[model samples]
Target chain A: MTYVVALDVGGTSMKGGLVTRTGEVTVLAGRPTGRENGPEAVVEAVRAYVGEIAGLGRSRYAGPPAGVGLAVPGIVTSATAVYSANIGWRDVPAEAFVPSGVPVRLGHDVRTGGLAESVFGAGRGVADFLFLPIGTGIAGAVVLRGEPYGGARGWGGEIGHAPVWPAGEKCACGQIGCLETYASASALARRFTARSGRTATAKEVVELAVAGDAAAAGVFGEAIEALAIALASYVLLLDPALIVLGGGLSEAGAALLDPLRERLAGRLTFQEPPPLRPAALGTRAGMLGAALLGWQAAGEHDVGADWPIDVLRGGSVS
Target chain B: MTYVVALDVGGTSMKGGLVTRTGEVTVLAGRPTGRENGPEAVVEAVRAYVGEIAGLGRSRYAGPPAGVGLAVPGIVTSATAVYSANIGWRDVPAEAFVPSGVPVRLGHDVRTGGLAESVFGAGRGVADFLFLPIGTGIAGAVVLRGEPYGGARGWGGEIGHAPVWPAGEKCACGQIGCLETYASASALARRFTARSGRTATAKEVVELAVAGDAAAAGVFGEAIEALAIALASYVLLLDPALIVLGGGLSEAGAALLDPLRERLAGRLTFQEPPPLRPAALGTRAGMLGAALLGWQAAGEHDVGADWPIDVLRGGSVS
Candidate 1:
């Protein structure tokens, strides 16, 4: 069976996978992006990881992989990694990340994750929705008409930076009242510590809030309110069919969904709120989406649509 | 030259025109919608107006009009008027508004104006932008990839009702701090009268503000700030290449555009603010867009691209 090498490159680490045409997956141990060593080193590390993954695929499937796909941070097109402030890269071609003679494709990291959700996870069968992953930093994949739309210049879906209070706290992005300032996973932890002078992870904070800790509850409450306001704006502006929540914070599950649903409904007077669902693919979304891009690079544009979700979720790991 | 019957249906008035395939236009005097008479009468009024314009087209060209296109208020599809709270209509088929056997098309009023801007006015050649008309109320036409988007259920582009201040003023829509509560033309007039204890039109309030009246300046300043906040949220979420401002308040010209540009820039910390320009079509955008839709119904989907801007602006009126 022919397979492809897929990589999801993040600010700190890279997850690699090998997938066959029918959705069988073998996930490899992740590697550090080594961005601290400089952009060129990071690029070299990616190439090396891809080469190693391809080597494994060749031994198992008895041939070179069909194609390669990498989901990279920052402004990306299918042909190039335009820019990534975190990775300190500029205009890196997709070819540089794969072996010579192999067709390769690239996608924006968050949008690729969103694409996975759209094709095989929570957003499956839904045409228009927002794929929002509330991680350390918040961004969204505006999936419209069955594809992620990155507006005029590929800087679209910066929903976290959109103001919630308009005149409230200053964000690290220098914008005032940005939703990320109160609602992102990093913000949850930071604000919780700032309020009570006790440090805790975002997950811990959520648990504390659920257990009725007043400081955690206050911080968590603000996050939910800020999220409600931002989501209300999103619903009014885009009127999506669904909102799929992902990333580290969504692990709070019903704790996040139940309150956010009620608050969002309260904010919107005239329209019904779209149902919110948790992301199904978890951290593997970017890598699986990369596999789809890999198949696209291999001229198999329709490959991922029929991939069984059970096989994708039940895949073996090494 | 063959022509089409085009009508723009508003709450209180209907504007009709006969537009030739080669872009020649004859605009007729508008008639009151007379909604006080009820919904059936409104539909009858529209059909009679369409018959009148088709008669004008036949007399002018010695043949039946090619098609009829109407831009109506509320939820609309190309083939049906789904619902209009203002017009109090439900599921009115396109054929009911025009002569039988003459192909007909319908469009949402604000989005139709945006289509005109996209095809022949300010948004010409721009692939993505927001066409916002701040008239009696505020709504937006989200023009993306050269077409207007109505989101999942044709309830999109309600930017006016998107909250600008989460805890601020109570809006008539039962939402808190909607953009319309502070920035709509009606809001300006009402807020000015409320603050100064003197009734004045929105235009007079603008003039007074420009001429150094403290109450007028305060009211206008708040409107601009509210607009800036709403627009900043739009920019962050959509990242459009440009923003086209239309409707009654936009007539303030530099008085509105200049301060708004400055404030919008200030709100954005990273991305460059898109250039804000006035809508080129003014009050006639809806009627002109209906002309394009009329052409589309005639299966001439590409007729508007070559229409001269000067000719559209200088169309004869009776």
Candidate 2:
């Protein structure tokens, strides 16, 4: 059976895998990106990771791998990695990183993860929805008619930069009161540190909030309020059936979801509030989505197909 | 040549017209809606206007009228006028008002007007754009890939309800600090009257601002600021190629466009500010858009076609 190489390239690490046509994934070794070295090193690391995954597929599968797919953060178009703040790359000819003669597909990491969720995770079978991953930074994927919506300039899902409070804090993006300034994981940690002079992860902040710390509660409350305002605007504009929250903060689970749902519902008067659910696939979604993209690029499988049938059959993948 | 009857139903009056296959439109007699007489009178007024326009088309055109199209306010879906605060309509079977033999099309006035602008006005040939008609209320139409984007629930462009000031005034929608409370034409007039204890139209408020009345300037300035905040969010999300402002306030022309452009540009940090243009088709856009829909329902014209080719030729349409 044919297999495909897939990679989810992040600033620090590259997650690689060899996925069979049947959606069975053989976990391949990861590599430190060494992006701190430079942008070229990052590209080289991605290429090397792809090579390792291909080797694993060739050793285990009946035939050579069909293609490769890469999911990267940034302003990605279909053919190019336009710009990525995380990777420190601009206009990178990312497809060239794949080995010669192998078809390659490139997509934004958030959108690719969204596609994975729409197929196999929380958003499964939902035609119109939003996938928001609030990690170090916030970004979103707008899934419409079961496909990611890339607006006119391929900037359809930059929901994090939306102004939630016009008079609020300044963002690194040079905007004031952006949703990212308050709701993103990095923002939560930074705000907590500034107020309490204690360096804590967003997870720790949530814990402190639950443990009855007033300062932590204040920071968390502000983040939730900003998220609710931004989401209210999205609900008015898109009216999606559901919103799936992923990324690091989402692991807080009900601590994050309950308040967000209540605040968002309160903000909406005539509009129906969309159901909010946590992403089920965790960090593996980007890799799975890359595998799906690889299958599509290889022309061996339809991306439109309800994929990972094994997962749908109530089976787990290890 | 076959013709279509189109009516733009407003709270106070109905603007009717007969449009030929060649895009030439003959203005038909208007009718008072007398909405104060109640919902039945509103529905009857719409039906009578449609019949009058159909009769006009039959007498003036070479063939009998082909179809009818009605543009109304409120939460309109593909088939039903789900709700209309302006006309006090709910789940109205709007298509039934047209004569049985004629095909009929129903659409929201804002979306229809936006379609008309996309085909023949300021947004002509622009694939992704926004049309905001800030009349009594401040709803918008998001035109993506040259068609109106009706979100999953057909509530795609309700920009007015977006919260601009979380601690600000209450809105009829039950949301506080909504953009409509400050920026809409009626809002400007109402705020001015409530403050100065004198009644004035939105147009008169603009005149006062231009004449250096500080209180009027304050109200208009607040409206401009609120509009800028909401538009910044839209730009961050959709990145439309252009933004077209229509309706009563747009008649203020440079007065509305100049400061709004400056404020919007100032608010955008990384994203390019879309060019803000006044709607060129004016009040007649709704009627023209209705005609296009009528032609489509009649199966005589492709709504997707670059229609009203004459308008593109720089010829006048009155």
Candidate 3:
């Protein structure tokens, strides 16, 4: 069976995968992006990883991979990685990531994960929704009419930076009252440390809050409130059918969803709140979405629609 | 020349017009909507106005009008007025407001105004922007990819109700810190009176603020701040190319736009704020948009693109 090489390039590491036309997935061990060495090193590392994955696909399937897809951070289009402050890359063309003859496509990192959710995860069968991943930083993928919309200049889903308090705490982005300042995973840990004078990861803080630690509870509660305020604005403005919550913090599950649902409902007076669901794909979303992009580059635009969720979730790791 | 009857139904009055296929417009005298009589009475009033305009078109052009288009408030689809709290109507079909077999279309009042702006007014040639009209109440038309978007259930574009402060003040809609509670035209007057123990229209309040009245300046400045906060969130979330301000309050011109531009810029830390422009069609946007809808119902979807701005601005009133 023919397959394609897919890579999800994060700031620290890169996850590579090969997927057949029928949705069989083979996930390879991830590699360091070598971003510490500089932007060119990161680009070379990505090319090496992609070639390695494509070589595996070729040996296994007796053919070169059909196409390559990479999900990269910062502002990106199908043809180029426009900019990424994290990796310090600018205008890196997609061709630089793969073999000369292989067709390749690129997508914005968060939006590619959102696209995977829309096609095969929580947002399946839903046309309009917001796919929000609250990781170290917060951003969203605005899915409209069955596709992710990046806005006029590819900066549309900066919901995390949209002010929740407008006059409250200063954010690292130099803004006041930004949702990310209170609600992102990094914010949770930082605020918890500030309040309790004890450092903890965001997951530990959530557990502490659930265990009834007052300081953790307060910090976590503010995060939820910030999320509610931001989401209330999102619902009023976009009126999406659903809100899919992903990212490391969403591991809190009902601890996050239950309070957020109640607070969001309380915030809105006239309209019903859209249901919020956990992201089904977890960290693999970007890789799977990259596979879809690869298939698109291979001229199989309709390949992923029929992939069973069970098979995708049951992907084998090599 | 064939024409169509176009009507804009407001809570207090109805504006009617006959628009030719080539964009010639003849506006009729306004009439009361008489919504105080009842929803059925209001529906009958619209039917009468539409029939009257069609008759005028028939007499002027020696043929029956081609179609009818009405812009009504609240939840609306092209074929139905699903709900309107202002008009107190529900599930009113488009045919109910027009003569038998004459093609008819309906649109949400605010979004219709935005449609006019998108096709022939301020938003012409822009694919994405926010068309906000701040009158006694506030609402917005989210124009995306050159069409007015009402969101998942037509409950979208309620930016007026989106909380700006999240804890500052109680809104009439029972929400806290609504943008409308501080920045709507009526809100400006009410807050000004509350602060000064004196009465003034929103326009007079703007004049007073410009003339250096401390109370008026404080109240108006708060209004501008509220608008800036709300609009900053809008820019962050959607990243529209432009923002078109309309309705009664926008007549304040530089008094509103100048400080608002500065404040909006201050609120944003990362991205450049989109340019803000006044609504070109003014109060006539709804009627002109209804005319475009009439043409759409008549199957001439491309009718409005070539209409000169001067011609649309200089329509003869009868």
The true-versus-predicted C-alpha distance at residue B241 of model 3, in Å, is 0.9
Candidate 3 per-residue C-alpha lDDT over B1-318 given as tens digits, one digit per residue, 9 for 90 to 100: 999899999999999998888788887889999999999999999998888888887778988888888999989999999998888999999999998999999998999999999998999999999999999999999998888988888989999999998989999999999999999999999999999999999999999999999999999999999999999989888889999999899999999999999999998987799999999998889999999899889898898888877545445666
iRMS, model 1 (angstroms)? 0.7
Give the number of the best model, judged by DockQ.
Answer: 1
Interface RMSD of 3: 0.8
Clash pairs, candidate 2, are: none
Candidates arranged by lDDT, highest first? 1, 3, 2
The per-prediction i-RMS, to one decimal, reads 0.7, 1.2, 0.8
lDDT-superior candidate, 1 or 3: 1
Fnat per candidate: 0.81, 0.78, 0.75
Candidate 2 residue spans exceeding 4 A from truth: A308-318, B34-41, B195-199, B300-318
Top-lDDT candidate index: 1
Local distance difference test values of all predictions, in order: 0.93, 0.83, 0.91
> TM-score for each prediction?
0.98, 0.93, 0.98
